[model samples]
Target: MYNIHWEEKALHELEKLDSKVSSRIFKKVESLKEGLHLSDIKRLKNSDYFRLRVGDYRIIFSFEDNTITVWKVGHRNHIYDRI
Candidate 1:
């Protein structure tokens, strides 16, 4: 299993969600740590970054070695030109 670390931005966004939604999202993210495809993740471009969908929220992260670093968590309604 890969280690998972959440950035301050992700943690902050997580706090904005209701307990049930937040818990479910966390579970999905943790599940990915166990084993996820690089093909699925590589779409994020360089730095081994990726984004996972959880309902209306988006999880931006990166995988390095045996760890996953969550960079941000945000609603789909927002515009993020980070790409």
Candidate 2:
């Protein structure tokens, strides 16, 4: 199982989202601990980060040494800009 760590910015972004959306994202992230691999994920160009798509939102994260570090969470149009 991999450990999941959320960055402050990502947590703040999640806080601003609708509860339903935030709940779904949180569920998905938690599922990663069970060895679930999201087929919808995409690796960012020239970076170690990968993005997981959850409806209209996107989760940007990187995995190393059994830990997944979430860097940002936002809508599809704006998520990439900040990363």
Candidate 3:
């Protein structure tokens, strides 16, 4: 199982979301600990990072060693813009 680590930016973004939405996103992220078997995961083009979809939100993260570091969290429409 990979350990999860949230960057300051990602945590801030998650906190700005609605409680229900944040909770759902958190659960989905936690599932990554079981490995990327979840169907929503996809690698970003030309980048080492991968994304996990949870409804309209997107989680931008990368895994190295035994850690999954979440770098950003935002709505699908805007997430890619900043990343």
Best by TM-score: 3
The model with the greater lDDT, 1 or 2, is: 2
lDDT of 3 at 6: 98
Error of 2 at 1 (Å): 0.4
Candidate 1 segments exceeding 4 Å error: 38-42, 45-48, 79-83
Worst 10 residues of 1 by lDDT: 38-47
lDDT of each: 0.76, 0.90, 0.96
TM-score of 1: 0.79
Q: What is the lDDT of residue 82 in candidate 3?
A: 97
Instruction: Tell me the tens digit of each residue's lDDT in model 1 across 1-83.
Output: 89999989789889998998899779988888769853434346554567787777777888788988888777767614543
Top-scoring candidate (lDDT) = 3
Instruction: Compute the lDDT for candidate 3.
Output: 0.96
Clashes of each: 0, 0, 0
The parts of candidate 2 lying over 4 Å away from their true place are none
The stretch of ten residues in a row with the least summed lDDT in candidate 2 is 32-41
Total backbone collisions, model 2:
0
